[model samples]
Target: MEFNSLGVLMIITIIILILFIMMKKIKNNDSDTSKKLFTAFEERMGLTCDVIDLKEEIYGIGLDRSSNTIIYLNFVNGVEQCIGLSEFKGVYVHRVEQNKRSFGKSKEITEFVFIKLLPKSDLAGQISLELFNHKWYPFSMEELELINKWKRIIEENLS
Candidate 1:
């Protein structure tokens, strides 16, 4: 009993489809996992920094959260501005939307997309886009420093 060409092709096609679906799921999960980790970082860091989540209410209450828009906070000077956290609530949310198209649907493949307003002047003098996941989009050093700083804050505060 030899294997038929159609049978072989069918097996190959099914395998490919399964693999593709699995890959998509994995990718989606990875990004969400990374976001989860980051979200924890945000919460642990407290209300000090603006937890801007585009998926949520991009437009926030101007009175406490942001006077103009929180998305613009990715400034060259970093997340820490003289604005102060206590006096400011925030215009951000808990979940941000995914703009990139990919295979996985529910995967979180390492928080890929990020935006920055400028470079961190104090840290290394200049911010490189690679401070991000080497994504095609440019991410300012200031944003990276803020993320790192918050991650550190979570480790120090929670741990």
Candidate 2:
């Protein structure tokens, strides 16, 4: 079998194209799953709310203006968990920082914003929600603001 430079280039290009298409398909599937989960949540809540953040099959945050509740939907290992909170023990925000050094390079600092849900019941453990950037980077200011606003609404309703 004789292969020329052009033939090798063509093969590489075809492989790249196929990989790209496959990635797009996978992303579309995740988006579809997210939409379905959101719809189900909305139906159960019986009120329309805007989705604040969706992390594919991981979790989602929504705010119901009519009921003044924060809807948290989480999917883990094929199990779906939903929490509708009009009242809670507390809402807390904190920052996490980590420093790491790799192969003689200077230390790198990574920060994350963690929004925690403290349920009133002793049976339920605290739940932490993380905010990320559009590119899936950690700690997004917009998400933080949205979460804070929802927390305030919930607190006011409880009072």
Candidate 3:
């Protein structure tokens, strides 16, 4: 077999081009999936508003302006829960440590955030919702800010 420098360069270029195209396709697919889920949620809730899609977590937050309600859609559990300011008590940031085995002999420690929900009723127990599982949600900082903003809004409305 006879090989030249130009041949090797061409092969590398082709591989890079293929990788670029594949990445683009994956990004588009994610966007499409998020859109479909958002539409279905809006239809089920019978109201439309800006919906924040935590695509990695398979859930979303939809604020119903007319009713002043916060709708939480959990795709994994197939549950739609709504919390009105009247019944909402408070929210806090909760953290948990997760340990995982990595690189055959190394252990990795990871921290995760959960927005704990509390209701005004004493009979109601606290609920902890995990922010994400496997991959880090890109908009996690923004999501946390949104949650805090909603909490303030709820408190104001309650009073």
lDDT of 2 by residue, 1-159 (tens): 357888999999999999999999998899789878877877876867754567676667676656666666655434343456644677777566666768878754436555677888889888766543223445455656766775665555553
In model 1, the runs with Cα more than 4 Å from the true position are 1-3, 48-159
Whose TM-score is higher: candidate 1's or candidate 2's? 2
TM-score of candidate 3 versus the correct structure, residues matched by position? 0.67
* Candidate 2 pairs with clashing backbones: none
Off by more than 4 A, model 3: 1-3, 75-79, 98-108, 134-159
Model 2 per-residue lDDT at 96: 64
RMSD of candidate 2 to the truth, in angstroms, is 5.2
lDDT of 3 by residue, 70-91 (tens): 6666666666666565665777
Q: Local distance difference test, per candidate?
A: 0.36, 0.66, 0.64
